[model samples]
Target chain A: MTRILPALAVAVTLSSFGSFTASADPLPSWVSSGTKDQIVEFVTAVTTPDSTDYVTPADRIAVFDNDGTLWAEQPVYFQFIFAMDRLAELAKQDPSILTTPTLQAAAKGDLETVLQGGHNALIEVVNASHSGISVEAFQAAVADWLDTARHPETNLPYDQMTYQPMVELLRYLRDEGFQTYIVSGGGLHFMRVFAEEAYGIPPEQILGTYANTTYEQVDGVPTVIKAPGIAFIDDKGGKPINIERTIGKRPILAGGNSDGDFAMMEWTSAGEGPRLGVLIHHTDAAREWAYDRESPIGKLVDGLDKGPGMGWVIVDMAQDWSRIYTGAN
Target chain B: MTRILPALAVAVTLSSFGSFTASADPLPSWVSSGTKDQIVEFVTAVTTPDSTDYVTPADRIAVFDNDGTLWAEQPVYFQFIFAMDRLAELAKQDPSILTTPTLQAAAKGDLETVLQGGHNALIEVVNASHSGISVEAFQAAVADWLDTARHPETNLPYDQMTYQPMVELLRYLRDEGFQTYIVSGGGLHFMRVFAEEAYGIPPEQILGTYANTTYEQVDGVPTVIKAPGIAFIDDKGGKPINIERTIGKRPILAGGNSDGDFAMMEWTSAGEGPRLGVLIHHTDAAREWAYDRESPIGKLVDGLDKGPGMGWVIVDMAQDWSRIYTGAN
Candidate 1:
């Protein structure tokens, strides 16, 4: 921990240099474009003390979707990849665990076959791979997997696949007294393992689809074991509902990349205050994946069609982002 | 808000003066005794730079039960009172809403009858009164009720019934970089309404028993409406389960007054670190209600029987508190 401080110090110094410059940019990875300008303007308006649009520190809540908005979700949602990987490993140990068609498909890495089986099949795969273990054991498994696994295409560690500009935006918002949260359709426990380290958002702030967990005394020690069922799938309308349920406040700003996040951004826009809705458009095939409207993961029809009319800033990833990931372009 | 600032300024000045004194106490409402010393020592050890128990700011989580622990919950849990009052109000407008015996009993202020009906009946009354309302509308109703409603015995506003020492402890813990959260069996929306003002805890930090709410476009705006059913009862084993589900980390400190909080404290204590469990034993009948084991609400037999053995500090309200409520002896 002490040894890593020097590297962190150098990074901070480099970031601080951008802040000290005449034309300073807190989000240095974001291009000097309309998208960046809109984000900066919204933050400035809300944070400026004398501005009519000014919001208090406590009310300065911002919610961002995890998969596509904050990080890359190209061929599939990364959590699904984790589930498939986990299932494959489990199947190798005990082939009997892949009892169902979907579980077997997932174990065989047949993404198309599993997707064709629909929501129930997806849930079966997820539950089989994710549940029936203590939360601590599951967390340990996720941590271990993340440490060794890399993105098939990027060859980068899965956690390192996070968007640089969005990471900077999160830091910038926190600096401006905004409470940043991840309202995702991803697995809660899986995201929690890396959210703090990768995104600088704490465990409590990351709200996502969670499994039904039971509290029991396992070997006389209190343990929360993940049960084999989805308690809630935080997608589409579920995003806003979970946001209100957890945060109990309408976020002033919402950032997302798909139809799943449409309601959240809509809710944020409906609040009678200075609100901003940012939709990250995956239009960068050179640096990142560019499938949108008809994408298997992160489908963006509603967001692409109705977002602009709602005064939401649609981020053209290829145009707006100068750097896709940290230390990479 | 401007009118209240001068009073707030004076309170801050007065509180600051204590820090400047030779033997000043941050928790002046608490007696300078073992209980107070223990709390201070635990915080100090975790905060000190070179201490073996030094916890980072992000990991310094503290959870407290809201009902009997942070505030007074004597005659009945305040949320039950709120539910009863709400039912009565609704029944006045439309008597048909009181379809069940439980609802009718609650509407008529028959506390004994309502209590006799048990958990399902209690839930029925709550569901009847609390459901079919938007989150914003429900919050407004709770805020209005809190403003007008007073404790039957003390005749003070329900929000003001919060214990002074506990409030100070919350502030002190926050000052020492601990993120304080309320984990209680109270209505989530009800507690969220006044939590910030009453206890300095933000809405997001307050976790409680929640109803199943549905999100819909009421008119043209996205609205979260409370539906009729208890989604969770955050008591006993559920406390630790919800804590892990929401926070994803075991708290360093757990504070409560009843057996409902036993699992939470046990979970906190079981974590590998310097942890503290504080049981607020309501032993002062003169200043506050003192029923424990035989009490309908906030029964504390397990806490009394096993807390000390678990290294938990038992706070005797009669002896430990110099002041019970703020601005009252």
Candidate 2:
């Protein structure tokens, strides 16, 4: 996938503001200084007309970890919130969800209670909410809930609260001719719901963890059966593995914001030629929230320590980025 | 899935000096005055904006059977030929292949002898060539071989021998905003090699028959392991099942020219919108050889009758299409 333009430059413009510009002058104000400088330098090294790292637009592969890198992953994942809301909505009809461990813990609705149980609690909550339903029904349920759902804490629909800068980067890269994909631990189907509308990337382009689907004949026609199988887990160490296995290309640009994304960034940096590795350090508490090493969610200290001048850019979310989200109304 | 263009009328333009524009400004020469009228009426019904047969671009999903539909599938499947070459290439280095029934058959270039075993032959051939190779290595091998090898029958590289008229039709449909995908019985990995270059489709977009692959940690890097699992066949009735299982969307346009493709065309026509089923009947034996029910490849009987008045266009290859493969230099 050859990129027509530089991704970092385009991303800065997109992340900062939503001002459409003439194609000849696509660069924006945020294209220089701080975070943009690091991004541009990496791009230049890899894409310079005659640089050794110079790969044609056809090989300008870039993959991003969606959770913290592309959006907000805080006290609890947004999907978990969707599940809790679903549980409450379904509780009116099916009260046993109140007794299901994961649903019960979610119904309790205290962040501390969830952290007490750890990863087990998270997977349990997800399986309880997502399994059993047909893939269509699950997708419809997700789409319906996403249409009206808002994060209780942020007070904005989860789609809006997505990191504004990341969205710009994706479009900038795509406009430049780079193929941008979401490789995340999040349910691949869940991401497909708002991915295209919010990010403008199609469902086929987004690759993430997915439950297995079965095939069967229905009535006179063949219909697919959606079942819960651990078909894919596109997260943590799985990120790089999944990308290579599916896309069959090594990414030149990789951006992530947590320990979960550490391996993904490492994988990008290990690839040949001029490469870009970036970490979105959340240090803006007033505009956003700041916590890295000590935070339970999105810890990035290890990556930051490794960043410095190691060809990896550490973006100070508070200062480097100028806006939150485009949230197109 | 929203398209930017309005529905363009599908017309065949014919000229008085024995040339045709392949559009309907002046009907095709093959469609007699009566046949042309019938076709115009059918097209009118299908494309009428308010008719029960009107189909939106979103509903214009087109599924194409590869093999004989796109490129020549004569002298046996191109994949088998490649596998035979590969077996011979790698045979000296690995002697155990001689003991493997399928490997021996392929290595010896006695494919017909191998097929004497019937289903067992197909199983052995697929397992030997595909299984155990890393998906990446297999893709590389395919790309490498396709780049160098020429089809014995055509003397043109396999990719160069694709049907030109069909290629143009595919481009036309894509320009019209139809989502196109290859539904083939060929091994998924093998098709991924030239699919994008030949059909303008990405590998991830292809849904085909597959022998499963596993995951293994080679050295420190995790690599996908391709194994000879029970093959996932995407031929005949399996085509629709695989399509529904993978894409979960039904196609409105289906093009194929074999019994294996009949089930696919039937599946597409079953959709509730204005459907188009085109059968490429090889009526030309001069420019190209013709065969039907007795031929081992591309048998086109069922689709011819069952598909006629129901909006199916039976292409008289000799009369309807002017060019075969696009000029490959």
Candidate 3:
């Protein structure tokens, strides 16, 4: 599928990212470093017809993990914060919800105490805040929240807190004929709300954890109600499973930031021919929150240790990225 | 996103399907009939920027159901035949499988008796035949079977049994900048093997029923092993659910051939803009096997009955389609 070009022409195309012209820098936010070079080299190799690693445009699938990889997950995941804020609002209205143990922890913003309840507690919070409403109502609610809600640490809207370098990488990939997809652990609808505006990935290409939905006719209007139960989890090993279930082909490129992404990376790297696995290590404390290997959310211990041996690229945020937050520059 | 082409240019573009020339017939196999005209009208309206019903190219999602609609599903669903053939092969190797009642029924090609055991029995058959194998191995098996297996009645390869007119429609829509997807009740991987080659729809765009898969390492190789459990069922109410789960947006156009597609049609028609619901009624018994209303497989009762009231285009196969099968001149 690759059109033959002269070596000089190929070099010009590689240097140009957004415009696809001769001299535009695709990853301007990305510093001229080994990590950036690695990304460019892999993309160029797969897209070049004469290269042994050439892959067709139809097969140029790139999956990205959302939480920490695309945006900040510090001081608890942004979705958790949304759920907590929602719990607070609901508690004020219901009053009775305040007495429930799990709801009480969530209302108090005590995620640690809520964690004591384990996976069920998280599911309960997610269900209470995310489900039982119509899909439209939920989407509207999320839209409203995201419009006003600011990250506690950054004081910027959650959408604006998306990493600048990563955003550029997404654009660059898309410019190069790769169909970019967000294979996130976040709620499917939650990501769909801002994915197109933030990442340039359309809703159809966004695969994520989803709640069960029931189809029904309400007053002559067809409606899909979000049911109060988890349908599919798009995390850890489930990531690879969901990718296969949704995409039907093994992705040539995948990026993530935690131990949860190890299996996804493993699955992508294990595919035949050329494949690229990227692990984003949060090592910028001054610019952005830096906690890895021991962080409660988005831990990166096993991935950091195993990535090098597996030929996966470990992107040290502080060193590899010239910019962190999109809001910064 | 539609450009305001000159009236002459618009007519030329519409006439030319593949080359975008002035004289090529987009639906050559499709007779110059009302059904074909209706399709052309819908495509033009949606693609015309000046038209009130105009939709952007990004939102121009057209979903097609496999089986009876796109291909022949007369003697039995092709996938079922593959399963039966696989069961026979397995039974020959392991005589003990014949001792089990469901396996015995499957091996004898008695789907009715196997279905009498209910949904669980069907799942058991699918698992016994399709699971506990690596994804690559399963794909290879399906590929090998497709290469040799012939339709019992048609004696044509299953892929060749596709409707040439419908194939033309797929290309026409794609040429008009619409993204085509196969939303089928067939297994996800099963449709994927032939979807791209037959319909020009890639694996990522193919949405269907899927089995659960587990990610694991087998002798230092990463593998996604298909587990012995039904992950998702993409039929009836499940179709709308899976559509939202996978596509994240309601499609503008949907085509199907059975009562199983009613909810999908309802979902598409209920969306906020101009939408089209197409029900392909099998009425050509001479050229193609005709079965509807009372047919055990691919039943078209409710859809044929309720489709007209819902503003759906009920395509009479004998009248609307000039050609039934691809193999037929």
Highest TM-score model number: 1
Please write out the lDDT profile of model 2 over residues A85-183, one tens digit for every residue. 776677768877676565666766655786778777776667666766656678899989877987776677788877777787787777666788787
lDDT values, one for every candidate: 0.90, 0.72, 0.86
> How does the DockQ of candidate 1 come out?
0.71
Candidate 3: tens digits of C-alpha lDDT, residues B118-222: 656766777789988988888889999989988877788888999998999999999999999898888998888888888888888998888888988889888
CA lDDT, candidate 2, residue B179: 78
Cand. 2 Cα-lDDT: 0.72
lDDT tens string, model 1, B82-114?
999999999899999888888888999999999
In candidate 1, the residue pairs with backbone N, CA or C atoms under 3 Å apart (3 or more residues apart, or in different chains) clash, namely none
Would you list the rank order by DockQ, best first? 1, 3, 2
Comparison by TM-score, 1 against 2, better one: 1
Error of 1 at B71 (Å): 1.1
lDDT, residue A157, candidate 2: 79
- Model 3 TM-score is 0.92
- What is candidate 2's lDDT per residue for B1-329, written digit by digit as tens? 13423222122222332343344343322335433354445455655678777667655678888887877777577887887888777787886776666668778888787766765666676667667877888889889999899877668888887887677666656755677888888877888888888888776568777776554567755466677675467888778766664455678778888888887788787767567777777777876668777776677778777778567787777777656776451
TM-score per model over all chains: 0.93, 0.76, 0.92
- Give the CA lDDT, 0 to 100, for residue A129 in model 1: 92
Candidate 1, residues A83-172: lDDT per residue as tens digits? 999999988999999888888889999989998987777788888999889998999999999999888899988888899999999999
